[model samples]
Target: MRIPRGLLAFGLLATLSATAFSSEPQWVEVRSPNFSVVTDAGEKRGRDVALHFEQMRSVFGTLMTKANVNLSVPLQIVAFRNTKEMRQFAPLWKGKPTEVAGLFQGGQDRSFIMLDMSIDNPWSVVFHEYAHQLMNGNLEVRTDPWFEEGFAEYFASIEVDNKEARIGKIPDVTYQVLQQSGMMRVADLFRVQQYSKTYNESGDHRNTFYAESSLVVHYLYDNLLLPKLAVYFDLYLNQKKAVEQATQQAFGMSPEQFDKVLRNYLSSGRFKYYPIPTPPAVVPAQFTVTAMPLADAKAVLADIHLHSPDYQEKALAELQEVLLMQPGNAAALRGMGYLYLQRQDLDHAAEYFRQASEHDSKDPRVHYYNALLLNRGSDIAGTDRMAAMKKECEAAIALDPNLADAYALLGFAQVSSREPEKGLEAMKKAVELSPRNEGYQFNLANSYMMNRNMDEAAKIFRELARSNNPEIAARANSELAQAEGYQLAAEGAPEAGSQLAGPSDAQSARASNQGVSVEENGPAPAPVPSSAPVHFVKGKVLAVDCSASPKAVLSILAAGRTRKMYVENSARVIVIGADRFSCDWKNVGVAVNYRDRSDGGGDVVSVELQ
Candidate 1:
């Protein structure tokens, strides 16, 4: 399982105690082509940690038939020399640290994998989490919980040596667990969602669910039925077919039939594993090992604490100590700046970030932090502030070209500064760097909207509306409604355009401004047309007189008075919440936007059914 940062409060170091830092071990950093491992378990262990990740990454790329496998966010691996050290970072359960060999903690900007080197096989836990990262990075579509967890479990058992790597080997514990707990029905297992009680609360049912899920995946892999899963998912999700029906169509088996097949396969006592030659590029001997300074190592740990919730005070204390020892430490300064930024102390954050930049101007993260601080404090109408933020973002990008967040911020700043084309380009670059990042994708959609590409923006919004993340889905739905309105307005529907343009125009301006300015300044005022003013009324349609074939006049009860509204062409008049305007309509609830006439009547622009 991927632990979300700050969700668990391991209160092991609630105070700034000397015991926590008195016996600080020697920390070494191992750098490979694609990963970094920081460990106090000697350089050899650190190198091994980095090599294992490289091997797994290689395997993932090979399996996905891609040359490179990207982790959307940066990852730092922390290996402890013993379980006692590892327990300090473990999740607390019943007021004590949960016993675990390894764990993965995820964050927006960075992720961490913690390991206990004393364990005989800590690889499985970390590998399982690493597989999830790989899946998130590689897969565009969200899949069922069963497939995701089962695939991770299967991939977790991977064993890589110097010459070869083995995959698809089932762990013996899975079989033992299933045998003792019995298995869930195939249909029941398939119906399990991420939030289902069976998947969330751990017990016999959960264990059985996982065991059966892994078994199903193993069977599918062995039978070469994995490729057909797309058909199954499409039929079930998009086509809205029943699970049994979709499974039958895709795998030539009903739920009951699959259940029997799985049980038979499990009882057959035959399991297959695949062995592939290890990629020559993963040469552990080629990796560089460097001794990390004590303060720097502590600073890294402090940064982890900063990311984890309920540890801010501890993180702050640690950073202060590190700075006290070495005030010019750039990493420590950056950590302090970020901690302050998280607390919304913009002034202090700026000060620390400035000092960090002065010490090490080449640090991309420091530049990015400074840019973030500037963006957070910027005035929406101040073009100079936006330009400064953009410059900082550009500097960060120059230092580290793959910094996606910097590009994202630059895009927002550029668009707000009225440089829509440049903003769109920067947003696209951010998405290109981190394709799986939904936030970047959202910004990219907004950029498209600023460029007046409503159709493309709406397309992205529609997809995002189905996201598993509620916040993203809610925002996407809101934007999608506005985008649809804009689409209708763009299609020469003047009445609809006038009615919908009010909120959307303001929202578009604020969208470019992003979160900072909008929160500070609220939304920009809606633009009004210099032509005839539009008036709105909501009431019941009393009657419609259509003595003229094409033209009609409706008597509406609004504001406790009867008013007549004229439609020059009833058939052509804009009608919302329905297919077309009705000539003989009566007693229907409606909202109308119109232009006032000289005779105390009104010329109807658009009518919306309520």
Candidate 2:
């Protein structure tokens, strides 16, 4: 099932003995290179969560091809020590009301997994549901229910430490149920969806379903059937073929035949086991203390409460108190940005959002709101306004894939920039994620019109024109008129123009570019010539840190030992034919280009995934 609602309480470390008795909950927020983790479970727990997810981030790159996952969206995890601890601080989702050990949610702008740390094995629940979230958010297409659940359960049994990941060996209760209940028919398994009655049946039958599905998954992929499985997923996912048809074509076996083979295989004692003897070590991109004072806690609360109309005044008062203590609090800055945005003060809003981004570069919400500010703000001279907006929106989405507004903004920019088909897809996803959001729906209609799908655009506009909200209705009516040949605007071909749009100072300063002012540590280093001897290093990436303001470091395991390579902030990152933004250096199996430095280190110029 997507959520195991009945399993109550998550397992959290019992590290801080004193905080439990405090009158008010003291919160700690940990920022990793790839994650923003908040916890009332204390700083120790917060750091522990960061370390765990960081390890998972490295392992995940190996789990699938880099193309299959969206590493850009920073993963968010909220793990409270227990239900009692969670109740003390109301998180995005209040889990105290229910018994679920954990729940994972994926959105257009962000994805998060909430875990209750009270359970004996909370990590299992985390890995299980996280697998689901990752697959859903990252995969280009929806996976079949049988395979999806099976894949999740398969990973749920993983056991990991600092140095290694032991797969397929962890004990699973489902395996015992599978042994006792025996095998299930393959066709029946394929027909079961998460919402299916069989899957939710209140008995051992449901357990059997989960167990058998995972067993089949293990047999297919773990038992040297990955190539066939990959072909099946390709046909089933990207190609959008019927499941039975894709399966037949990819595996060359009917469901019944596969069932017989699976049964025979299960009867045999042979099952796949995998152990990574030298798995990548977990390294925090940037490690810093996450402890906060009570005033700052209130600031974070103010930021959270700003979203609710009823609590705006209360939050403003809280922010006033917080800013009095810490003037540069990112949360307070973000709150001010949001307030200005609500008041339609675009310039001030943009400034505040930018300030917030500068203060907290790892915070996805900061980038998300900043992107919104950029989209609503005036165009800059040197920047491709549409491209800049799209880039910020993409970065926002990369940090939080579930953020509907980011997708909406990117879709609008894509349509404005004349990528109609791509715009239509993004806008459609935005509307799907937030059906009640009028802006997303309106942009989707615009995208359809841009793609010249007048009929679909008209349908959406017609529906929206009936809404009781006057602003939406008026805009929809106007769009409907345009869709129905009202000649609101005439199309024109693009004239020749300069393609190399320069980045703004703000854009240049971001991690993607080398615009940060470098501090002079000593005498100016001699510049390497363009004709300098070039060297290549091909190996698995052990670590990557672009968090440094003016430089990025990559640690690659090549020729046995780890080699530290320094990359200027301006170094280009390429991922073959894929979009450059999707290229993440931390991923395994990247190729690096560099010049051997005089100090024995390598100065990397470019990193490519080919």
Candidate 3:
């Protein structure tokens, strides 16, 4: 009985009260630089688990370094003392035993693990699932099953104590199965696809499959085939060639010869357990531990569920109960801030975020959300709003250097304020921390383009265009077409302030053709080219004269002073959030191209709402 992460749903049990579980157990969170461990197993036990995971991080980090694979992302773990406690929290189990030691749930932006601490050697289950989470993203769409499962199973036997690791040892079950069964041919194992029934379900074939996969991986490691195997694996994952072809190219050995060598190695007993040299002392991520009431923990769960749209209703219900029990809860407040932001009620969202930030000033997430609201408001409020957003982002990064999204938000603020180079560096750091995050990737790509590194920009854009997500793919293609000097047909109107990149030279070009038009059906006349160089300026509309119908004169705040500019009736007009414009200038906040004319006044070449 496996509870798929995608299917694991929870809601407030309508009839249950926080007091119902008050006497059962209490939860506390132990945090490390790269992992968070939440458990009801007492403070000492929680700290021990945190340290254990930190040790695992060091061990795995070293192995991945040797293999030249970068699995860099913080992880979270939720551990329960027993199945009963797990059911109370998870709700989807409906009081049934999950029959598993641990479960790993991965998403495009993050990953987490849930486990029963009472299970025997639960660390092994953690290692196995962690391996899957790491490999799932980097391994290409065409990765070989033998290598995937074999590599995960091989790492599952890791044992660490005080910085020393005993590696390549077989699990008891694998050892037993191997001792009872005949060696599987390498060719047959290599041909096994992930969807094969034997690999996915229970049977004698599945048992043998695990044993043989582990044996082959150990064999490869013992014979020093790891480097070549790593290259072969990378090649296959990158889809550079078929697995069979990559295997031959990487090792220069026929499948039959490889099989013979593996069988001989297994029989020779040369593949034995080995010990890693003592690792350097690791400074774990520091976290504060407060004994949280059951209701408070439930609030945190509600916050987590709020990330998925399907769970929002349930999250709201849970949050209501949480607020009932603990008024002014930081988590619940932040969750409401998120809900209001989604609804585009910026005023309410800002109020909630400000309250949450005041409640927990040191919390990185609160600051992050505050930064988001401030950034959105910057479009209408000018430089001061942008400065505030920058400060909030800096606060978040200072509190949690590993919060990748904070870096991204900081990057956006930097770019909008006309410091493209500084923005690019921040965006790069964000991508480095969470390479699998498409949003971060998109920001990095856009930053690169803004910095005039077209080659790098095009490379990322091409990759994004091929993404599995339709909307992302469409956006990527649109950006790529623009990069290549063409335009994608507009898809309705995008919600204002939606795209990661805001008003810039590049974005101004796209907006000129994308949204603002005199008539809905045809292209508007191009803005008059300034014989003199043009400068980009962001400001709120001070006043507009539409008495002259086809032509309008506008006064706006640019560069700390009021500048009047002539706006031709043919000028491109765009509203950021609404996507379309009615040519009315009321309540307009815009980024415009200011061109100096021979008459000693500036004329607007393009006017784009921010």
Candidate 4:
């Protein structure tokens, strides 16, 4: 259902000059409850765009039986007056701009939907991408590429009128394409992945893949077999069953039999669609429209370029131009700060963020960016610095309560400051806001570990160890092993290196670790004693001296100071969040727990790659 960015960029350049306006078009911003539409297509079209999105969002929630359908990341819709203007923003192929009726660009902090208003109906392509975003926000588990794309295609044909919305209507072009380029086997279709050549390449085979995927979903919906999809996925993914076996078990038929049935259904030309009354929440009359300054509008375009890898320089130029016209423009300042942040120029990023904050104290993004910059800096070991980061995160959350990233960062800061209970609560809130984010889930697990809740931590890590993302899976597996070790230690196992001789002995050990004296008569019930008093530091590894083989020395930059940490045995040292420890590691962010050495340095206990 998702069109490749390359496809959106592949068309003749001759059509670029087809439409022209007699006078410069005015840009306006249309605001609804859940969406923002910035357009040169007049207020009517802008209001219609906002209303359509609100209606679609409501319909998605109703169909899924979800109470909230809001996306975690902010989205901005840009409606160009004509194809000519839209072409200018399209992705470039071989140094030339490619034509497109609509394009969707996704990012971590924000997303964009650009439409060519000259076209009568430019919603299909954008709608497909929109469906993917909605699923990402609502679904807890990642589904197969086939199901994901097929379901998006199934919902992409949604047509809305004043009273109701019609869904599941297949376009005639799909049938024509599939007929011309014969379908693949059902098993092969099910096995296709996002990285498969057939999914990435542009050809008749790819066209047929999309068309057949949609037809299969349509068949499932019409036959009332949609509920069985969970069974199929559980068999294929969790049980590790083959595509053919899972399909046979879930659909009550072999792949070959299902193929025949699907072919017949396609040939019979009989399909059903769903009609549901529009929710009353979507009211176009209540939407607000206001003229936006040209400089500010250009800043949004610059932000779009900033998120694109190929257009960073153009983004800088546009931001500079905006600043020249309006020196104190808050949006432009924030964009500049983000641009510098992406480039890893921390000083400039900090300065721009500081200026932006002063100019617009109420902007949540400025506060969020400040927090992010602090998190990425090397001086976070200072309590005051960490408190500043937490304050920024708190400000951002107060401004935008649904900002999941702010809660995530706040949780990290709290954990680093040794406030495990507060960290756990903040991390839970983050996961509640963005349930599908594996990274947030990983952080939540880490928070549980800090709170000494090993069972909960291990459960999350076990689930994440099976993730499709290789990095997250590797990290989860490593953390899962550590969590198990912690659980054993908590149970007073000798193998975990924390077992005490007796309860009195454990109290004495805990008092010794805490630098307190034990009572002469009898000590009160004491918590389990850890290995030793370990100091935590988060910073960059400046250099590694491995001249001593197993006993390597590390130069780390923490709290704006260089500290020397000695590793007893590099091979035996505990490493988390990475597959293996490397003596050559340098300039990478890392968190270390170490004990103070007699030489005024540190003896490394564990290292966590950040």
Candidate 5:
């Protein structure tokens, strides 16, 4: 049934009026939207999400579409940075409450797609949700367990993205009604009480909800249901036409006729597949980027012709090859440095950035990014490395005087070097180029405060305080108050005298140790305090002792905990530090792949829960 006219009208008007699905999300002047986005990360995640989706699409297309079901539908996905993000979207769910990730509303033009990036197969959940979205976009008819869920489960049965991959057929829910009660054909079970169901109404079957629906969908796919699906889509979604009319229009038959075929396929209980005799080839464990040959080296360099989307890894890899072939190939060395920096592979990134600087003394991107990678965050490589990186950034900037990124990189370097003045100048220059960049604006304010330029700092802080971003704005307000107090003291009546009375701005700044804004540091949490720990963990898995096998780790299955700390990853090591461990461990890298140790979920991969 349609939503109450009043409610439908109200919901549509409300959602449509709220910011019209941002045209250029990246360019939007994000004032501190909600949570602070991590900086230098340009809508770029450390791992490839879009690639994963494409790989999924490619694999699914190869397997499912070739056999039958043609479920191709264009979809716009909203990938969240993490679960912490919810203020950005309104829930668009129908039926019972959905979990962290799913399609909230399929009926509307812009539906909610929340994928918890923290999960390993976030794409898998996205794949399941897309089935709903696709069905809504294509068929336009509302469906129940036998259709909606069955299709989702069917689509989820595609190959996983691993060298040695396996796919198993399983239902989303256990104890399905068809297997247990043997009542109601999948055809009728799929149809909703056309007049009563809507997004707000909640009703769903526990068993047969997911699994049976999936099996039914698989039947349709195997039995050539794509054309029928297309027909449904054309009739209903395309024209908002009625079901019987759409069925007649697409299949040249009434809806009742299609229902008959659906029954025959489902009841047969036989599935179709060209079974894999052996698992897919698993590549060796050794990690190495493939290299281009000597002849291909020149072609590779030619490939990196500035500003090309198809810039191949070969172009960069070839540079390495060329350097190896002739150690002093300045062009190749410089190219290698450029490519290394491009990938942000800092040590190699630095080597190439250095070569470019040495050969040309002016390439901006090389020096700028090198400085950034070398210094940013924990300084994994150390401060001396950062200084060298920043120095290169400065040289790159000096050579051109208009390198915006170089300025940005230089600003970070200056901050790390305790030279807020130089940092302030660079940050300002960067802002001039990209005025809306949050990181630049943020650093500029910090630089101002460091130089005791509180008035200017407060101005920027006040501006950012009203942004859509919560983290930066919160920090801005707190900083604004500090700046205001500094202003009051600057007017006289304080121990710190004004620099204006003594000498030039630079001289006075140097004398007073000006621009030294810093947060106070306190004691760190000690490991010994684990004694007073409020939460004690159970069923701890010990890392393998003296074992060469990387996967020889013990599985720690504690009761009442979904969060599993990985012994292979850094989690358990830090939590249970080296000092407290009684168990002898092997050469690290041991991870319990699955927590439950069950095979029911059909080739689902699980890492240690935590």
Candidate 6:
């Protein structure tokens, strides 16, 4: 049976203390690029992680000053080289090799936080854990998963740049990916109460809890209901009142009523991804190879004017022709494989990857894709191909050690191959290599949890839950809440900082809407427009896809008239409608937009293509 909730990891750490702590605790150096300790695995990475941490601290300092909010906690985030090694610190299960990173365990009053980094947006993860730090370290209150986890997931999604942090919103990607596919309605997706039982009785619907919490946070923050929400938080923290009480007081309605409104809001959109709708009534997207020579195929890929199950069919068909023209066209083979993978047609993907590998022996993508294909198989070949898959994955890594994707794939292969420890180690390397990608961290956490290494599992979950990007945090907190004693530790992180691009950089970030916003006073250069396309930066409103409702809705931002992606929906307005607004954009609502289908060629710019 699984370990009981509320208490499990403490015993191991307590035991370790009894055996070894005769002196005051000095931070043990892990594999970070920032600081180093005179211990094992304390060479280069410690300093790297420290450098990254310090950078994030500086960024946070500026943001707080700008946002005009004071935190009661000193948030500390850790950057791990990889997932497996992060988990190694926890009490290794029988024969296990690692512990969890990004957990909030062992520290007094839960002052310690840990996280594993493997993404471009490290701040998202940092903010999530930082939220927890504020609750425990500063507030000095008994935080609940329902509130703390939800808030962390909500904040990490808030992105900031050009000295301005964006606030609450959902990711357009969430809408895009599910828009034409099988996705739930916003009401079911955004309802906060879904997380009430993340770790209730007989397990939890982890993903649903996270998605729902993010949606709920989106509705509240989008509608500017946080101050009111705070009142509920106050009551919940002070009297340990149930969410039911908090909800009634906070919204002046029962949870069911609130859920209904949210559901209506989401369903009204008319776009969703899920249950594979009967073949789109119209012709789906198709890539075509209209012309071909002995060594090349004329390939033209069109944007799916509207999403369809066969969105990439034309592209895949063209890729097949390219393979036929030059049986050894590695590029063509690789393209076909990836396309199939996206469609989740593992068999076809494997077929393409296999040929791609044979044609380009040194291409890491080939090996990585091949391994992915092998793993995707649902038959005996898959069950028996572990050794082969590991070899391919290792080969991919060997070709390019910094290929974070390879590291992640290898970790899974290793674990599946029964060398769980080695697999875990590979996962650590994966996180380190890509310290800014979510997929790797997600897989790493899964490995630990599945292996019954709760400490390690819980740690990664904490990092994810406390991310600065809502998507990342939402997913993380949901899983963490379900994991036993996950709130015990958390890793600290620092912002990666930005390299100024142009006048439109801030605008671009707004379009993509990726991370959280913070307060600062520095006069960042006015973002000048360049070839770079705008992206929604989580907190602020930016671009709208051309495919959205064909209304005269202007894309959000400071510009517009031509239905541009960077158009503003409305000026940033603080709740209570006061001047010099300190819009605490700790809640990024969503990420969406389409890019110009032409040059800087195809830099995404549409929330709904015009």
Clashes of each: 1, 26, 5, 0, 21, 159
Candidate 6 structure lDDT: 0.46
* Candidate 6 per-residue C-alpha lDDT over 306-377 given as tens digits, one digit per residue, 9 for 90 to 100: 012333455556666666657778767777767766665667777877787777798776787777655544
Looking at candidate 5, the ten consecutive residues that score lowest on lDDT are 525-534
As a TM-score, model 3 comes out at: 0.65
lDDT (C-alpha) at residue 598 in model 1:
90
Give candidate 5 regions above 4 Å deviation.
1-344, 355-359, 376-390, 468-471, 485-610
Q: Quick one: ranking by lDDT, best first?
A: 4, 1, 3, 2, 6, 5
Off by over 4 Å in 4: 1-24, 378-381, 488-542, 545-553, 557-562, 565-582, 586-599, 602-610
What is the Å distance of residue 44 in model 2 from its true position? 4.8
Pairs with steric clashes in candidate 4: none
The best candidate in terms of TM-score: 4
Candidate 3 lDDT score relative to the true structure: 0.65
* lDDT of model 6, residue 57: 35
lDDT for every model?
A: 0.78, 0.63, 0.65, 0.80, 0.46, 0.46
> What's each prediction's TM-score?
0.76, 0.53, 0.65, 0.83, 0.30, 0.31
Candidate 6: regions farther than 4 A off: 1-314, 378-383, 446-456, 467-610
Residue 551 error for model 2, in Å? 54
How much does candidate 1 score in TM-score?
Answer: 0.76
Tell me how candidate 4 scores on lDDT: 0.80
Give the better candidate number (2 or 3) by lDDT. Answer: 3
Candidate 3 — which residues are off by over 4 angstroms? Answer: 1-24, 29-35, 66-74, 91-99, 106-111, 132-149, 161-164, 172-216, 233-239, 263-270, 276-298, 301-315, 339-348, 375-380, 461-610
Rate residue 487 of model 1 by lDDT. 61
Candidate 5 C-alpha lDDT tens digits along 162-234: 3322344543342345556443443344443334242125434334444455665676667666557665655
